[model samples]
Target chain A: MSPTCKLTYFDAMGIGEPIRFLLCYGKIQFEDIRFDFEKWPSMKPSTPYGKVPLLEIDGKKMHQSAAICRYLGKKLGLAGANDWESAQIDMAVDTITDLRLKVTEYYWEPEETTKQKKKETLLNETLPFYMEKLDALVKENGGYLVAGKLSWGDFFFAGVSDYMDCVVQFDITKDHPNLAALKKKIRELPAIKEWISKRPKTTL
Target chain B: MSPTCKLTYFDAMGIGEPIRFLLCYGKIQFEDIRFDFEKWPSMKPSTPYGKVPLLEIDGKKMHQSAAICRYLGKKLGLAGANDWESAQIDMAVDTITDLRLKVTEYYWEPEETTKQKKKETLLNETLPFYMEKLDALVKENGGYLVAGKLSWGDFFFAGVSDYMDCVVQFDITKDHPNLAALKKKIRELPAIKEWISKRPKTTL
Candidate 1:
């Protein structure tokens, strides 16, 4: 049976975007609900973990965006070919997550001086190190993040790297040919391309 | 052939303990390598992600503690009964990870003043809310974090929550009856009990 699905998040390509990309890639339809930050306080009380990117399946809500992606990846056959492959996929996704948290740590800083310091650390040291390593991984895996096949890791990296690129406000992939190609490849997919064409745009 | 495994992290339980607990739960043998902070900078360059909790399998190294846990969960037949249950397991583990990170953010702060303030926020707001919710989740699932069966999520939580309890310098389970019971149930298991009996004790 086709389960009713709804995804709720702030109107931005934060963690929510990857889940959206995964659903679309699988040709699954869901109610994509987004609201402004002003609406979050009231909405927070209803969320499972007081966080966005919640997935409601047939009215039963579940939290954690990465977990959701993994579950749906399995159901959609985007997980991996086998358990070992799944681990590889998981490893790739999580490495990206660590990189994401570095930026989020900066975002959550309330002090301007501390925030600037974090931004410098992210740009000067963290970003180059992680991006370069990941680019090499993609190349090693024959242009995908793992197993020489398209998995949730690819969708995850493709989704979050877009946000990372926007925040860094530069062509993050300019120096890495394979990662640039990965972005273009994922972006050009029929489902993702269509979703991106119509999805709400904001300066995330 | 069974692959040889080596798990490396600091001498503290920290993230490595959960992975250790999972392996021990399965009665899987591994080389546990622990180091001190003084030795980390030199070791960092060789690590896959420049982080600890590195798992080396048959000479190939990989990173990400949670991902490593998931892989071992499957291999040990402690993941879940099926895809849906595995999703629930993933959800539980990731949710606990979210809670753990809130505590780690404070742990990473270099400023004593900032650390104390963060500790206050954790004590007054974060710990109570999350522990209460997790307690409820455990009760709802009938004394386990996910399925009624023992899974890696249980081991992960049992291991990390111990560190959380120590860092907060109190028994966080003091008020959460279900979580307390869950912890007791896991800790008393034959393998976990045996591992705890012999593992090195650290302040963290």
Candidate 2:
């Protein structure tokens, strides 16, 4: 039998959404446990690294969003065909994550002056640089993120795109047609569509 | 036959050493290409995402340090015995990466006052919290990072520990005996020892 799975995270979609996407893509039934800032202090100590987006499979708690995504991707046949292919997928996922983090660092900056500077760099420099490269990848790979076919990297990027947009106050898909199409394709998948429609709504 | 391999990174260890360790552990001979800061401007445009630690195997250049390390680890039979074990190792590696980044943020801070504040928290809170948790993990897993056996995560931690310590000006092993022993075990491995003795020397 499939092990009982439960994923815990904040109500808003951040890193948690990618993991949720993977589970939904695989059609795996899991308890979507969400909480808020008020409950975080009490819950932090129980976590392995005081971070959420934790996955409990058969009562074994697992942390780190990337690791959990790869595990599920591998189990569900969404990683790749072999080690080399999986490596390509992993590289793409990491790249997407790198770009995501660049946006987030600025988004969460406390001081207004520093935050504005970061935002300027992110918009004028970082975002365009990454978006162009990623657009080329999607176009070259026939509309998928890596390995020329659907993989968890695609799910991951699609899942986090909304949060990224909200954080940056910009539509990442703005001139990146290939990436926009890829996101649309992934979102339209039956399982993902169902999950998106029912998942808790949040601004970010 | 093993595919011809080449690793290109800065003259420093930083993120490149773990991949080097994996290749050496498996006795896979490859070209180790090191470059200086002056050469980076010209080289940056050639990289996938304007980063170093690029690994080229059979003319296929792959970027992303974590992805390259995982690929090498899997090929070298050091990733894990199975999917679940690989996931466990990935978690440990990611967790270590998180702590490493925390130290780096403060270490690279330009303002003295902010840097000092970050250092205070790091030394008083961040370092101890992560070190204690990681130490317990190594002890429980019997001198390895995960799955109760040697894995790529062990190599990654050992390989990066010196850089991390140098940046933060602290001996992480001082209070974490189990982690210390684990590092010793990895460094003393015949292959890793040979690599360490012969590898390029750098402060970080």
Candidate 3:
């Protein structure tokens, strides 16, 4: 067995939750390290980019949640075997990440005018566009995002859909039948369902 | 031989440059596709996220510059072989990406108050901090980002440092000796140098 992993983040789910879910579902033992706001100042300097979701494998620390998740996926044999599948998986995850970043900008905007504009753009343009593409990809790939198998990208997409539903007040899956079916299928996976049920609740 | 690859983006050496460099350096045959502002609106809707730097492999389209770069890296044997090395490469690339996004925000802020605040935070807190860590990592990993060989992460970092030097009035590599050395090393590579010389020059 490999050395145990340690993940550091704030108490909230935010960027770190998907990684936590992957680890738990893979049955990998890891330390779920958390920090309070008061402690972040001291902790900030120690991280690569002074951000959370740093992963410690054995004794060496690695930062970036996407990188961490990819590493865990490879380690757990969740990433596909060949180059094409790996590329496809990376593509799908990157798409989800792109959507998530837009959502992040909505939260970070301080002015009501800019925030409203962003929200309008998201609601009117971004949301439906991504939903349509995701739905199409799901259908094209035989109900999976890549290689027609359960890969990390599927989980990442499911997580993003769940987040959008929670934060954007949009019933993402409901609007896109394929996406809705994909989410339901992912949730019904025995290991994933068990992991979701047993995992600690997080406030993002 | 594989079918010809075509990449489309703005004429500038922005996000599209990395994929261009990777493909050219790897001796992969690809069409260097570019466009101006007049073409962007009509072209935008065709993109997956209404963004550029899309790659067409064997006539199949792919979006997201990072994902395209990673896919090309794998095709060109630029990404590391094993899980650990691949993770290190990905982590480094992702860290650079994080900093780039923050830097982009500086340009996008419309308010002077917010812009000033972002500039101060970035220069005083974020910039030097990331440089120091990157310098240490480059040194620790034997002058390459992963497993002592030139990986896609090295190119990604070089592209970032080059962009900072071009756009921002600050000397990004001067403060960090290892980072400066790494950049120089990447620049000195024959294939990279040749590709750089031949690359289309444009203002982003």
TM-score of chain A of each: 0.95, 0.95, 0.88
Model 3 clashing residue pairs (backbone): none
lDDT (tens digit, per residue) of candidate 2 on B30-93: 9899999679999999988998899988567899888888988888788899888899999999
Docking class of 2: high
- lDDT by residue (B68-136, candidate 3, tens digit) is 888778878888978788888888888888888777777568889989999898888778878888888
For candidate 1, lDDT tens digit of each residue in B130-153? 998899989999899887888889
The sequence of per-residue lDDT tens digits that candidate 1 reaches over residues A24-52 is 99877898888998898899988877887
Winning model by DockQ: 2
lDDT of 3 by residue, A1-204 (tens): 644788888875677777877877787788888877678899887766778888887577887878888887887788888876887888888888888888878866788998999999988888888888888988898888887777878777776666666567667778788778778887787777887787666544
Residue clash pairs of candidate 1: none
Which residue runs of candidate 3 sit more than 4 Å off their true CA positions? A1-3, A36-39, A58-60, B1-3, B111-113
Candidate 2's displacement at residue B133, Å, is 0.7
DockQ of each: 0.85, 0.89, 0.76
Candidate that would win on lDDT: 2
| lDDT, candidate 2, A174-193, per-residue tens | 89999999999998999999
Candidate 2 segments whose C-alpha is farther than 4 A from its true place: A1-3, B1-3
